[model samples]
Structure formats: structure tokens, C-alpha cells
Target: MNLHSAAPRSDDRDGYLVSRRQAWFAFAMTFALMLFDYIDRQVIVSLFPHLKAAWGLSDMQLGSLVSIISIVVAAGGLPVALMADRVSRVKSIFVMATVWSLATISCMFARNFGQLFAARAIVGLGETGYGSVGGALIASLFPKRLRTTLLGAFFAAASLGSVLGVMLGGVVAAHWGWKAAFGVVGVPGLLLAFLYLLVPDYKTVELAPRVGHARHSVRSFARQIVSTLAGSPTVWWTCLGAALQLVVVSMIWSWLPSYFHRYHGAASDHAGMLAAVIVLCGAVGSVIWGVIADRLAVRRPRNKLVMMAILCTATLLVFVTAFGCTMSANLQFLLIALGGFLMMCTVAPTATVVLNVIHPGVRSTGAAILALFQNLFGLAVGPFVGGLLSDAFGLQVALAVMPAFGLFAALCFLLATRTYESELAKVEHIRLDVATSSTSPMTVSA
Candidate 1:
């Protein structure tokens, strides 16, 4: 339990643990795996029409396929991340990728909706700790100053993967069948998982400094975690805000294809391509906004939270106008794309904030808490809620209402900003317990 062996062995003086080459190599491999992770998960979106045409499923049933993954991921993220913190992040990730990839491939063979649903749940189990673990690895591999931007870029892979998944699902399904798309995307992960094993691991860091105990015990471990989490109000608020914002993001990403098909009368394949454009903008927005947030905080760390709050407000406004107003389709599409960019502004920066204030030793575990919020309350809630609203009102009305959740997210970010500077001050004295060999996987969309 007192594994204080997670320090930078090779380059402690400069602050980053690994050499530049090693850092990039790790990033590339992790990024590739993350890309495929989403691809396998999301290829189902473009198949919505096919599945519906075949099964005569309702909107809720269709959305459940996406929501189920986030639900399982949220329920399971903490324990898995805790294990990764204590064991090997890299090995854990390898196994996770392999499991999810295999599960995705299994989706290709399911004969009924129930069977496919069960297979999809397995995919979520495989992805349980990936976002937090991956975030921990990248957070440790790079220098402290670059955390937000690099993490943003890393998460951008989710959108990119979703882009390909959606696009490929439509195109491939158009030529072949829906099952073929899953098989196409799932196989690459197996190769990537094997290659991921080559990435090294850092020693497990202790959760918190010991308090009055002479010997370590599970009681003490749980106690320390409670103490750490209870004291950091920033983590709680940030988690809430991140989860709320992701509600909007996930709704758009999950339903845009359906929206185009239902409203614009686009074919399934064409709808997917149109939706991919917005997702691609989100990928680009995440990185751009992350860099902007990082820059804003260069002088005052609290500025990062300030920027997040502003972005959330901007997203809320953009979406209300885009969806509520009756405009030409092309102009509405443009506004929706802009909203895509603004919507993801918080994805990377939220993780950066969590990493910034939390105890360095239990970074992965801390990140998993954030992941739980992002997955369960945000991404998990989005699609299902959208489906419900779509059924009750219509898809148009559902999309219009989703962005309003950003108001709550913004308030939480503002609340976080109040405590952000003070909490950051506390983390300043803390240092990582550097271990030369170590390993981990994480996010909203991850």
C-alpha cells in the first residue's frame, strides 16, 4: 500500500520522467489504442438505421446501445483504475484493449438485439479504466507544464476515432452489411494491444501520505482516499461540471447521424459523413481550446477554470440559437459545427484540472473519479435522455434542450474557480515518487 516508488528516474531534474522520444512513442501507441477504442464502440451509431430497419427498435432501444457502455464504464472505472495505480498501467491497458477489441468483434455475430446489447456491455467493461489510466500515463510521461494541451490532443483521438467509425460504418454498411463494419474496426486493436505491451510502467505511487498509523491496512487506505477526496472540493465540482458538459457532447456525437437522416432526409451513409464533420470539429476544438486554456493559466492557474466557464456559456448560447431558431439548413449546420468545437472545450482541460489539484501519487485513481462522473452522469445520461426526449417530443426538440445543461456545468466550473487557486497551492509542495519502470489508461468520451 505504501508503494512510494513513482518518481522520474531518468530525467527528474528537468521534471519529465521519460526522454522526448520515449514520451512521443508512448503517446503514439496510447493515442492509436484510444482511437480504436472509440471506433469499436461507436461504429454502431451509423448502423442505427440498419438495426432499426431490421429490428423495428424504438429510439430508446437504439440509444441504449451507446448508453450501456458508459454506464458499465462508470460503474467499473474506480476499481480498475485503483488496480492500475497499484499494479501495471501498461499491462492493464493491453488486456483491456484486447478484451474490448474481441468484444467489438463479437458484436458482428450477434443475431438479436438482446445479444448485441450484451456484447456492447462487454465492450464497456473492457474500456472501464482506459481513459483515466491513459491520462495518468500521459500526465506522468510529459512535463507538468504541458499536461492540458497534450492531454487534450490525446483525447482528440476519441473524436477522430468516432469520425472514422461513423463514416466507415455508413460506407462499409452501404457496400457490405452493418456487421462488416465492426469486424473491420475491431481487428486493429489486437495488433495495437500487443504493441502497447512494449510501453514501460512507473512504480505505483502511494495514495496519500500516512497519517498516525504505524502499519498499513485497508482501513487506512480507504481512510486516506476519503480524506484526500473530501478535502479537495475542486475535484468534486470539476467532476460535476465535466459530467454535465459531456451530456451535451455525447448527445450530439451519438445522435447527429440520426438527426440528419430524420430531418434532412439524407441517406444513412450521407448522414454519417455529415455528422463526422461536426465530430471532427470537436476533435480540433478540444486541442485548440486546451492550448488556449493552458496559455490563459500560464500567469494564473485559476485562469484555466475561468476560461472553461466562459466556453461553457458560449456553447450554451450557440446551441440554443442553432437549434431554437428556424433557419436554413446550411446555416444551422454551420452553427452546429461551431457548437461542436465549443462543446469539447472542457474535455482535456477538465482532466488537467483534476490532475493539477490532486495528490500526484494516486493520479490514476483520482482521474478515475473524474471518469466515473464523466461516464455515468454525462456520457451515459446523454444518449438515453436524448432518446427519451426524441420519443416524447422529437429529435429537434431533444437537441435544442441538451445544451441547456451547460448552464449547470458552467456554474460548477465557476464554483471550482473560487477554490482552484487555493487547491493548486496545496499540490505545489507535493512531488511524484519516481520509479524508472511503470505503466496506466482514461475521459468523457474515452
Candidate 2:
């Protein structure tokens, strides 16, 4: 029997009418949450110079905190991601939001490395839920045409968060004290925690008919992940590319403030403002790139991923010039902003390409694995690696190293081109086949 709400004719209560405005509002709300999520992650970076002085942190000690925070995300993300697939996304995001917010504010209580490390670890744990579920919900809510554009718009929230975190962290650290930086950036997240409730829960088709069952088990979830990776070359390549991207992205987060202060003689606030400008440029770049990718992909199927490769290469070149070569401080900021813009342009395309190639059932899991690599390797090691290099060489030399990493990311995406094109073709073919099968059926009589 046809339910009245889902009745054959109307696009209403039974049928689930989703307007473009609703889709965008959802994107904006989640985008704001994601913005804060990132603020908590990198707020420490802007505070790093001060935090180091106050906490008596050696480069190695500071590196350890960054490393452990990323490592925990790497180690814990998959397990938690698996859990996300099996639970209420709403509950997971809510709980994770609370955990990270509290953990962030708890930084105010840290008088030692152990306290800070523990707080960072908890923040990582909370981030796992946010990153995994947020993308999945966005994908399910938007139509195919709008998915990448919307995701790009949402992902730009990271830049906004980055801007706020760095600028605020610096301002707060300089004026109030480093501890207050944590509290100021962190406390707002608690308020956003309640906003998570207003967003609609994403609807998904169960893998098997529910049959009144408990959700997926650890063993089963593991199998699904294995199967997903095994079946998906796009996942593999995207992960590889994202890992490299993370390294550079991570390096910037972990070290740029220090670089500016040490080299350009900028104060904390000035350095933080520069970082914020770069991130703000990144936010704008991401939205523009999404629009470009969407418009181009409509004609050329592989344009989205191709654009990612090209932009990464361009970013690598600009970043090398910005950091590796000598220029006036103003010129340096302008070049760096351009690089940030190019690098950020890839986020939407990167996410869109990954989403397009995966089965819907495991989108969260796939996104989880992507996050796992990003945090585990890219974010996990980026800051520490930059620091370690800074300790070994000079800060200038350490700052110069990440462009090479960006180059590597460009290569990974370029290498994956054949696989990406093939898989996307398959996805499109399957979609066309399904549409054809549905429309061409039921010739009943002779």
C-alpha cells in the first residue's frame, strides 16, 4: 500500500520535500560546527609560541603533543568511524561535540604535558565523530549536482574556523594569557553543541532489512571497511593524495605562526593575522573551486579529481616561492595567500570525487578512513615533523620542507588518474544502467 505522505503525486510530508534553501541551511549549520571543530584543533598553533614559553616546552615536547594528538586520531578514528556507522549519527556528533568542547576548555587546567596531551587526545576523539558523520549527512541531503558545491561550501568552514582560532588564539594569548586563548575559542563550541540538534538526521537504507536488530558488530563493521577499501581504487588513491595534502596542511597549522615570528619579526598578533588571512583566502578558494568543479564536471566526468591534482601542483609551486625563496614580508603574505587559495580549492573536489566513487552504505566509513589517514599521517606527523626539522636544521629550513610534501601529494593524485577515471566511469555506467532498467521495463502483451 502507498502511504499518503509518500503518495504517487505530491512532494510533501509523505514524500519528503527538500528545498535548495533547506539544503543550504543544513550546510551552513554543519559548516559552522565544522568551523569550530577546526578551531579547537589548531587554536593551539597560534598559541604555540606563547604556550611554549609558559609551559616550558622544548621543540621535542611540543612535537610530542602534536604527534600524540594526531596519532590518537589515526589510531582511534577507524574504530570510532565504525561505531559511527552503527549508531545514531546525531548522538555521535552530539557526544563528540561535548567531548571536544570540554577537552578544549580543559586546556585551561593543563599545567603539564600530560594534562595537555590527554586533552588533545580527547579532542581528537571528538573530532573523529564530527568529521566522519558531517560529510555523510551533507552527501545524503544534497542532490548529485549540488553535492560537491555544498560540501565545498561546508568544508570552507574549516578556513573560517582556522581564521578565528589563529587570530583569536594570538589575540587572547597576547592580551589575556595563553590559557584564556583555549577558553575563549573552546567555550563557543559548547553553545554550538545544542545547535547540532536542530539539524535533521540523515536517512540511510539499512544494509539488511532491520528485523528488529541491534546495529552492526565490531567484526562485521571491520569486514565492511575491508570490503570497501578492497573494492575501491578511488578510496585508495584519494587516501594517498589526502595523506600528502595533510602533511603540508599540517605543517602550516603546526608551524607557520612560529615561522612568521622567527623570520619576519612579527609579533604574535601580526603572525596570527597573517595566518588568518591565508585561511580566509582558503575558505573563499574552496567555494570558488567547488563551483568550477561542478560546472566542469557536468561536461567532463573526471574534471573534479583532475582539478585537485592541478591545484595541488600550483599550490606547491606558490608555497615554495612563498617559503623557500626570499621576498619582502608583504609579498610573502600575498604569495602565501594565493597558495592557500589554490590548496583549498581542492577540498571540495577531493571530497566530491571520493563520495562519487563509493557505495552509499559505507560513505561514513570511507570518509572515516580518509579522516584516519589525514589525521594519522598528514595531521599526526605534520607538526611534529616540521618541529623536528626545525630542531635539526633551522626554522627557515623546516618551513621550506612542506612544499616538497605538497609536490608528493600532487604526484599521488596524478598517479591515481587512470584508476579515478575508470572507477568514475563505472559509477556513471551503473547509474545509467539502473535508470534504463527502471524506465524500460514492463512490456506485458504480445
Candidate 3:
């Protein structure tokens, strides 16, 4: 039987054309795991004060703890994602989740900075591949038109998870202890890892038969990665643009609770709750911006990248005002929330652009590459730089200045507009060729 006959058509016009029940199930599970992923990652930030006092740590040391995980993730993401593309995404995710969850649990037993840092690095190992693979899975399960909205909502899970992680970490640490907070948050992910095994997944594009020797698969895989990266300039621009925009996001999420505590004279839990509210606004903004971007794409197909540029521009302006001005704390809080909303608007649209331009054969790898840039530039550097600035100039000054990086991000997106349509057309042509080839009968080897 021809595999193309079994595969779902991309052009089916009836609304909700994908496998509705199974896709939603997979999405829910994937989204839940993403939520936990951030929860485990961000919970440490909420405990910074406690850890500082107990360990006699400096601001830079606290920041390094957060940045180290991203450093590891950025380094490991591409290789692990390539492995997922060649092997099984489902099994890969299961192993990844279990490893991270166990790593999170190990944090509770850490006796010092070295132990804790090593445990966090292990957490990074488990998380590095999950996002790219999950994005590919979700992209495959849904129609192309809904890509932005679906992925926007999917990525928004990070914000929602961060909110819960910070909020709960503060509350738990205040009452029980910082170590207990790690255990409480880490256990649920273990349960979710088990449940995730039941979610449906499609075979990767590389699994489709090609006119190539099995022994040459490794070389072929590396060639595909190189070709995908070289052919799609949009991927390069989008990744860099998203990374630049995320500098503001990483700084805010990493340091906002501390800002509330030191600047506003709020308690640890109070600061965390307030920061979580701001983060929640970003979550809502992601979904709203996704819908708006989709509507704009419908009206003007060329405006997708343009919309991202506009959003990043707005993010730069809003965040700078929110942080740079010395308004009443109430007004600052409101402006910060507003800035978060605008900042988050870039997430879904950028992801949609990446998916649109990359070949399905390397979608996970493409996403992994994007993750590498975003994490390396944004997650790994943003907080550490902010902390260094904080130590030198003060926390408020550091944060106030960070939003300006979004300007560079906006420029990257604007540059991407030039090549977006051309790259998208190329991907569409590749898909058509693949479909045509898939429909042909297989020939027996002589």
C-alpha cells in the first residue's frame, strides 16, 4: 500500500480538517508538559532570595544558576532534535520528560551550589529537544492556516507555566522551605510523563522512503540540515529577531519578582504573585496577537513578517517606557503588564513563519536551530547581563535599558520581509514534489 494513500491531505477544505480528537489530545498533553517544563525551570527564580541568604550568593551567581540551564539547552538542542527526526519523537519526549523531572527532584537534595547547578544542567538536557519536537508534532497535526493560532497558544504555555511556577514556588518556599518547593513542583511532571505516552504521533518526514542507501542516512541528514539552513534566510532572521525580542522577556521574567521585592517593598510571595499577574498578561497577549496576526495574514498575505516587526517595535517602545520611567509603582505595574502583552505577541507569529518556510523533513531540526539561537542569545545571556548591570548600576537601571534590544529584533524581522514570500514559495514547491512522488507506485530493487 502506498503511504501517501494513508497520509492525510493538506488541502482538505472542510473546516477542522485534521484528526480532531487525536490532535487535540496530543496538543493537550504536549501543552501540559510544556507548562511543567517552564514551571521546573522558572521556579528557581522565585527562590533566589532564600538561596542567596542560605548560600551567601551574589546576584551574578543567582543569575548564572538560571542562565546555565539555557546554556546547556542551547548547546544540546540541535543534536537531540536531529535524533528525534531520525528516531521516534514520542519515545524521545518520554525519555526527555522523565530525565528533566528527575533532575528537578534532585534539586531538593542538593547540598550546595555545585550540586544544584549540575542538577539544573541535567534538567536542560531533558528539555532541550522537547520544544522543537513538540512544535513539529503540533504543526503536522493541524492545517497550515491555523498554524499561528495553534502554535501561539502552544508557546503561551510557557508564560502560564512560569506564572504558576513562580507563584507556587514563593508560596511553598515561604511556608515549608525552598527545597520543598522543588519537590512539590517536580512530582506532577513525572505523572504527566507517563500520561504523555498515550498521545498519538505521526511518523516523521524522513521516515518516508527516499532514493538513497540506508548506510548514507547520517550524511544525508547532515546535508538536509545544511541545505535547510542555507536555503531559508527567513529562518535566520526569524531566529535572531525572536532572540533579540526575548532579551526583554527573559530579563522581566527573571528579575521582576526581585524588582517588586526590592523596589516596591513587597514580601517574597507578594512580589511573586504580582510578577505572575504580569506574566499572565503576556500569556493572554500571545493568543490575542496570534489571532490578530492570522486575521492580518488573511487580509494581506505579505503582512505576516510585517506584523512581527510592528509588534516588536511596539514591544520596544512599551517596555522602555514601563521600565525607564519612575512613575508610581501602580502605574509602573500597569505599564509593565502592557509591555509584557506586546512582547509576547511576537511568539506565535515568528513560530508560524519558521514552520511555513522549512521543509517537513527537517521541521524539528529547524525548530531546534531556532531554539538554539533564542536560548543562547535570549535566555542564556539576558539574565546574566541584567545581573551584571544590576551589580554595577542597580537592578532598576539594568531592566530599564534591556528593552532597547527589541529594536535590533525589529530590524531583523523587517529584513526577513524581503525574503519571506520567496522562501515560502520554495517550501510549497518542495511539498508538492514530495506529495507527487509519494503517490507513485514503489519499484522493486533488482
Say which candidate scores most in TM-score. Answer: 1
Instruction: Give all candidate RMSDs, comma-separated.
Output: 4.3, 7.1, 4.8
- Show the colliding residue pairs in model 3: none
Candidate 1 residue 262 Cα shift, in angstroms, is 1.1
lDDT of 3 by residue, 1-446 (tens): 23333443556522332347766877999999999999999999889889988999878888888898889989999989888876767668999899999999999999999999999999998898888889888887676778889899999999999999999999999999999999999999999998887766555565245665655466776776797777788899999998998888999999999999888888999899999999999999999989888889887655877887888888878777887877887788888988988888778888888878887777888888889888999888888999999999999999889988988998999898888888886655333111112221321111
Candidate number achieving the greatest lDDT relative to the actual structure: 1
Clashing pairs in 2: 5-14
Alpha-carbon RMSD, candidate 3: 4.8
Cα-based lDDT for every prediction: 0.89, 0.73, 0.83
Ranking of candidates on lDDT, top first: 1, 3, 2
Better candidate by lDDT, 1 or 2: 1
List TM-scores for all candidates, in order: 0.94, 0.87, 0.92
Q: Give the TM-score of candidate 3.
A: 0.92
Q: Return the candidate ranking by TM-score, descending.
A: 1, 3, 2
Off by over 4 Å in 3: 1-18, 207-209, 212-217, 429-446
In TM-score terms, candidate 2 sits at: 0.87
